[model samples]
Target chain A: MSILIDRNSKVLVQGITGRQGGFHARLMMEYGTNVVGGVTPGKGGEWFDGKPVFDTMRAAVKTKYADVSLVTVPARFAADAIMEAADAGIKLVICLTEHIPVADMMRVLAFCRQRGTRLIGPNCPGVMTPGEAKVGIIPAMVALPGDVGVVSKSGTLTYEVGFAMKNRGIGNSTIVGIGGDPVIGTTFVDILEMFENDPDTKKVALLGEIGGSAEIAAADYIKTSMTKPVAAFIAGRSAPPGKRMGHAGAIVDGGEGSADEKIQALEAAGARVAANPEEIPDLLS
Target chain B: MKLHEYQSKALFQEYGIPIPQGRVAETSREAGAIAAELGGTVVVKAQVHVGGRGKAGGVKVARDAAAAERHAQAILGMNIKGLTVEKVLIDEAADIQQEIYLAITNDRSAGQPLLMTSMQGGMDIEELNRTRPDAIIREHIDPILGLQPYQMTYIASAMRLPRAHWRSFLKILSGLYACYNKSDAELAEINPLVITGAGALLAVDGKVIIDDNALYRQPALTAQRDSSDEPESERLAREAGITYIKLEGQIGCMVNGAGLAMTTMDMTKLYGEAHGIGPANFLDIGGGATPEQVATALSIILSDANVKAVLFNIFGGITRCDEVARGILTAYNAVQPEVPMVIRLQGTNAAEGKKIISEAQLPHLISAETLTEAAQRAVAAVQESA
Candidate 1:
């Protein structure tokens, strides 16, 4: 019932010998993700957390038949790692690395698109199918299995919104962190389309922040197609103009990508917009 | 990461694109010397990161060295949109026959770099795009294939550029694309790609904004970063690996993650709006931040005298609550913050974190389980103190 991934998905961890990869690999495994193997270029033929380690994604996929990949490589090698995963026939790849060069991402995104492979993020928290499987860095305890599907452009905000939903006794079927980079792999429309088709997702929560027209475009999609009740929250309502609020993409440029613009767009699209995270549950209801 | 006009022109020159000879000068005397060397008429333009320098009288054409010095004196040390003009670019003026615009920027919706051109240039492109959208012709360049010659021809023809200027336009366009690609620039713009009276095409004004993430590979560009352009607290936060932005409010906020920090600000604003109070600052400790970094963030928040209360909202995933709690305690001892504090610790050893805060027995420190309650309490504390 989960979109993109579930407990049955065989996952391979790329750059598994690295600190971030190693830490998140264990966490994903602890959350019942089917992490079959890991790939660390020179550290092949080794074992990490009782899983096989290979030198390349080709070798890992051959041995474990991984359907998905969790890429935690450093920024410099993230694009290569993603392309390698996509080239190795991995249907889905989630990159958690941040600060990746934009040109590299452009190439990697093109490569993945050519192969019909879905890539999640290069600076994102990854995805979680609550109670089924977890990928990336979202804390496992914050999520629960339910009918609401959540998607956000931020990691911690995803956790905050999920926690808020959990507090209201509402859980999520799947939650996707699409990253906050200016040039990211997935868009709000892409995740919204996936959520709309998932049978278990009775309602959806779309969390966005300042910057980019993704929220506006998502509103258009929701207005035209989405039948599920969607509650939306846009952050940075009080943010000053022209200041980059931490995220590379979260900047107000040329009077575009402001919080007010996004809120108005989403509200006009018929989705209830929450003033804060606490109001998300009621808005969805 | 936005390069000044002189920097962008330097890159443009390196890529073999023609630009009016220019040199950056810090002092008005140096500007006059450069202007005298260039001879004839010269333009003294202020070097700042913001736009609308022309409207702010940051750009002026001087007919002689003395006039150039006067312009530099007027433009330099002048504050344009809150940014002080520390340097000015003195360049030999050109005889403009016509103006055209050329730029390369990422089109996020298309997921590719877009090369936009307009026959109407030398003015506000935003206003042009808004008023006459059809005047600007845009073509998305595949990052892998790059800016092909055919694509350039397509755009040039679409703009109905004269046959005589096509060759030079294509060369400049290619060079501009090269500058954008080689420099790792998110945006490379040549407003007023002027066709001179002497039948030469030159980039009159250039702008290149390097991708901050790609700066690691661009050592030269990274070195050109103007720290003076940023606020003191923002600079300190960057050094400490925290994300901080100053605001005009009474309640300071420190949270984990950019999204959460902004949400915390929004919540504070929502509850505090009625009380005529809001968050004083936006500070994100970032994921996996150390205790010392947290302490540094606290000190920075407390440094703001207008802050009547501080709110700490931590949802520990990679950031451990206990580590943050320890950092808070350390900062409390060091900064001796007089303002009332509301701390909400959740996720990852939150119980231990709460125990640490409670055991500290600081009268000003208050703990909450939810963001709503924490924001409400922080606003109420600020109101009561006021």
Candidate 2:
């Protein structure tokens, strides 16, 4: 029981002709994702990598019965793309694009909340269930089906945690990157709720970074709703103030979003904090 | 992007918020002329993207044109902390009978926009919150509803505003929110939203920081950036389309994996500061970084003036170790860096990749056993360079 995706989920690729979409589609197919079709307007009736192309999501979903869509369109068109996906009745959507305008996500998130569309990311590495289904850009080969369900905002850190889990022979049920954007579609709390209910997931390793109060909010949620054992690592412990580490949401404004504050909040909420990357493996045990 | 008071006030004016008449002047002569044109006393304040300017000798209240000119001369030419005082804002002085503060910023902890107002102003809000929490009022604004008129009215009335100034305060409060939303700001603050003795609400000082991710949509805000204040290496890295963050580590890191790159830095620190190398930088070439991109990342890492040794810690999954080895060899041939290098390649094609790197036989290129070994070798190389 992967939290969000499994082998039976049929997937459609938005902007299937784009470079990023084409590249990751091949990887997903190789990883055995049930990639049913591709969608790019004006490119209907064409094919790429053995997948049929349709002009609209509604047409592709109607013909192939696609239940999932991987969105790779630009930020300006992402909201419309999501709405189209919702109208087509795709239950799960993964947004692989980065730097989506917050206003666009604002409308998209509000719509998804009302319409019951589950979003995995807008700037994330996607979700993967080992030996089952994969969506997004996560390296499928490194993952294995196991008890730990991983979720993170940082891709590199997710890779680190996954590699550590692998080194310890502790497999992962699902690893979903909620993304590093301020207005991310999925939160740790959302994914934590899913993981808590999943029989396959006995534990969760959450990797967060400096910036934003998502960690603190997640802490509050974890205090009550979480049932699985949770281990977390918040990077940027020694990272200087004021400079954005990289992502737009990584700004250390007014000392509120510093790693120290996040660590304190998480510790208070009963999370075992991995102070650094090397310490993460120890926390997992 | 942080705008000075004058710029933010200009933005405030556009949103119909009432601000005192002000002009930014670069020189004392311009300041004197502006003060003279204003007909009387004016306040001269330095323009910097930081707070505590009043305590830092950057703000002065002058009685007349001569006093305003002197204060402007003192502020314009002086340096506050590390930032140069290049401009002074000249504005008509307000008779501040009461100082109230207001701001709107994303409170990540609350997972929404936060609206903070205080009867206590012109002081450290944090200290005030700790010492006298009741002096301030905080509200978590719903992202969907925003700060509605009724909420603003409630806060304004609770602050005990005079009946004469209530309408104006309401207008200014709405306008502030408009400015906050219009700029896509992460932070918008007015420290001294004063009620003048003459009973007029005045926004004396204000600041706004537009979100960097929203920069593509905010061309004016992006263009207002001062590149001079940025690190040279960081600027060059940005131009090259590489994600590089300068650090204090002695071992300069050029890695294909961002996660491994960070772990490399952490493990390097674990080995101790024998060479006092702060994290030289955080470079993420992203997944599927090509040999050319790898080579470019190498060149950028080597280009840092403080870098004495360069460490390549790559864990191949999607990024094949052989391709990363090829990149190192290519960058080595191109840049011909004289400093030492430690290469830690694992995962795909590790054996073949070792053979390829060893074949190059570059003088400074050293292969290590583990991340620990690589960090030690890099630190030793830095000492040798020193």
Candidate 3:
């Protein structure tokens, strides 16, 4: 009943020959993701982890019948790989590569939108439907199958909160890392709608950071549309304005995108906002 | 990645956008020479990154070359909003008939590039948006189709700009968009696009902030980065592939991810409230960080004299916990840190990581099982030291 993915999903690994792509591909496969094939432009007609490799996504898609793609190509080539996946008729593409140029992402989002393909991230840990299938870089150890849906902008915090919650006997239906880039393919509101409709998701945990009005928009959506109980945590309370705190999108610019603004908004929306990630499990409970 | 006025103007000129004839000078003599060459009353504007330079007296109009030199002397080396003015732009002053604000930037909410303009210029756009919302006109450009001729005309007409000036206005607006797109800029702005006494449009001031991610492709713009504008520690952190921002607290923080690092800071602040202390710095070693980078991050944090304790919160995903523990030991040997330290390692080989730290037997090192415990311990260490 997990949203976005399950054990039945057929996944293709783009840039499967690269270091990160290769490593995470094995992890995803080990976690029971139906990774059918791999794609590397020049190194086609090869085999990686017992899966067939092809030169182009179009060829791989035709042969493998993969509906999903995990793009772990280098930052410079990631956008092109995403467009390639969309062009090949992949319904969903998750890009875990970080530091992609925002301009490239703007074009990629437009291209994907035109093709009706849902792109997840350019600088994010990918999605995980725990105990069913996992994509991207979320560690298998932390993911446990249950009813709470988790979405976050940060990869490690997602792991931290999910791991802690799992230890407290609260497992997750799905965990989505939408990335911490100024321009991302999916937004918190987008995932919130899906989580609300999923019958398996009884509650949701949102992890947001400083930057963008995504949290504010999420709060608006939560107040008006979401019926599920939601607990949230907004990071970077101590961050100063105009400083990029690690993530390119995690900057408090011109007095906007502060943690206080986001926390206040979420609390006003009837969702409990945690002062720390450690408090989120109790709030969700 | 914010370009100075002179740099933005240079880029504007390259894109066929008209800019006042000007050059940047580091010395007053050079400024006077540029002023004289322009052959009219000139304005000496201090080149610094912060806004409100006009209010700070960083801007002055000189009626003559000598006056320009004097103004340059006063403006140069002056401090504006914590940034030192090292250069000045000497340009011919325009006879303004009207001021218009225009800019092109990414609209994250709309997921498109936005063009915002106002007839009321020489004021902050946010202020204008608040005080006179109707005065601002905006259009979202499709990233694929880009800024079309019709959209340009629509905006110009909406502004009620005279038909006589539409052609020039369209050129400048489209040129600015082209610069914005080609440069991969997050923002390209011409504040107070003036209608001169001659009935010609001129860009009085310009600003461009290139996306930091896109800087890899923009080598020329990357070279234009002003290193003097940042602190030495920040510069070192950037070079080490770590994200570090200095703060005025006592606990030095090193975490794996940006969100976790920020959360760690928040946690320290929340718990440190009792001890009257907080995180002294925000440092993310980034995913897949090597022991060398961790050691480097530690050195950078320890270098901050304000730091009384250090907190390491590493949740291993792509980043391994054992490697970080080894890095901590390596840094401990190198820096001989006297301040107490709290380390929390979880997920992805947490057992091996804990074993490494225990075997290192480093002095002043404490272990915590959870983020809450780590933050409390870090603050307690700071309090004990104090």
Candidate 4:
């Protein structure tokens, strides 16, 4: 069994009428995800890809009984969409929209915590369980079904690592992009717990970048909690200090978030740290 | 997204936080005039985004108007940490009885906004937290409940603030919170929240870093952006809806996603360092960018003369590979780039993209099957060209 999602999990696509939402919703269905329903505020009663669209998440979940939701709304309305999904009882929500205001994310995060609903990303590529279900925007061709579970903060980096693993005949159990925003829904520790519990997952590969204490926290968790062998890659090792490396969260600030510091912490915690993506397969082996 | 000290103070003043009367001046004569209006005893502080302006000699106390002119003249044209000082804030000097530190910033680990206050003020808070952690008091604010009065009082008492200054301090705290929330600021800080000899609490220095994500909704705050401090390419990239950061190297990278772009840069650096070449710049065309946007990104990369070879790493998710290929061809024809290029396309419609590239068979272009191969080829190409 894969972590977070599987073959039987029904998914709801929030903001399904929008360009990105519609496109990815179709892709998810093509990848064997159980696309159950769609939700749009003003476009109710419309059918997208044989799924009924509802104006509100409550009505859609009530009729379709979805267990998970893919939020594809714009950044301005993403927080409300997430809160609606949580209130409608979707246990797991994956947000694909990026650039969500930090304050809006703080409120939504607190709300999701109170309701015990798991949120993946507000600026992420989403999650995928290979050979079962795919949610969010990760290209399905890059990932193959296997025993290694992957978690990362960057979307393309996940693809790069997954492609490398695939080239080495190392398929993945599940892959999660927790997003590269300063404030994200899920942490490395959260995904690590799931990977450790999944019996199909024999090992994990965590792809991290220079920012935040999430990797350090994950290292601490791996040191104390897990028995699975983990190989990790931290990007932006040579990035200049005080410069943002594309991602909003990928910045070295106050000497706190740096590749050297993250590498040191991960190494001390018994995790093999790969210097480059090409080395991840060997480290895991 | 970082506002100048003067801009931060303007927002603070709007929120009822007391600030020393200040005027921004682009000229030394204007600074002297402002200092004369403020009774001749003024502080000439350079306006730049980088920290440690005081250490950089960007800040000075002018005892008279003539001194103010000299100080402004010296600080205005100076470069502090690669950012040139274009303007200076001339403000009335305060008679400080004591200094305090107060700021509101996001605590990413807690997924909440943290309000931090310290008795030790006018110093680097990070340094203070490192050396004297006990001197700071932190309170996590509930986004819904906000900064409660009791929470403010608790922090004030924890910092051992005098009872006489508690009310005004609370007002400043609330005002700062309002500014942070209303402005969509990632950080709203008053480094030295000073208590004057007249027993008045004032925000002596202020800093506000607005969240770039929220800039779309904040038109007024976005208008405060000083693009002069950024590189010309960065400013142009922002206008073109791409993310670009110029670096010191020979291989220019154009990638689809931020994470992938950084990884590409890292890989380029790793392989290029061995070959005595490194990534020249960081450019992300972002998700679902059009062919024209890709063309624009390529032009930006080529605009830098230091680049000897261009590396294109595209993993199509929302970004279609064929579109990126078309954009590359468009840029190749338009810019007539003399430098060599190594391209790697994968995922959505990658075969179609590869067919497009092979069909064109542009001169000096090398196609690779993977990121590692592409980086290696680009590094080798740059070294060969050099």
TM-score for each model: 0.98, 0.92, 0.98, 0.98
By descending lDDT, how would the candidates be arranged? 3, 4, 1, 2
For residue B143, give model 1's deviation from the true position in Å.
0.7
**Which 10-residue window of candidate 1 chain B scores lowest in summed lDDT?**
B286-295
lDDT of 3 by residue, B1-386 (tens): 99999999999989888889889999999999999999889999999998899999999999989999999999999999899999999989999999999999888767789999988987978788889999999999999889999999999999898898999999998899999999999999999899998999988999999999889889999999988889899999888778889999999999888889999999999998776899899998877776677778889998899999999998986667887778778878877888888999999888899999988887898999999999999988988887
Please state the CAPRI-style docking class of candidate 3.
high
Give a tens-digit lDDT track for model 2, residues B1-386: 67778888888888888789889899999999999998677899998877778899999998888999999988986878677888899999998999888888766444466788888886766777777788787777666667788888888778776678789988888888888887888778887889899888888888888766678888987877766556677887787777788876666787654444555666566564544665678787766676677677777787777777888877776677788788778878877888888898766577788999998877988998556678778877777777
What's the DockQ for every one of the candidates? 0.76, 0.38, 0.83, 0.74
List TM-score (chain A only) for every prediction.
0.98, 0.96, 0.99, 0.98
List CA RMSD, all candidates.
1.4, 2.8, 1.3, 1.5
* Model 2 regions lying over 4 Å from their true place: A220-227, A264-270, A275-279, B109-112, B124-147, B158-160, B256-264, B273-275, B290-300, B347-351, B369-373, B383-386
DockQ of 1: 0.76
Tell me, per candidate, how large a share of the native contacts it keeps: 0.70, 0.20, 0.85, 0.74
Worst 10 residues of 4 chain B by lDDT: B286-295
Over the stretch B1-386, how does candidate 1's per-residue lDDT look in tens digits? 88989888988999989999889999999999999999999999998998999999999999999999999999999999889999999999999999998899988777799998999998867888898789999999999999998999999999999889999999998998998999888899999899999889999999999988898899988998888988788888888778899999999999988888999999999999987999899898888776678778988998788999999999987677888899889888877888899999988789999999999899799999989999999999999997
For model 2, the local distance difference test gives 0.79
Tens-digit lDDT string for candidate 4 (B79-198): 998888999999999999999999999998899999999989989898999988999899999987788899988988899999999999989999999999999999999989999999
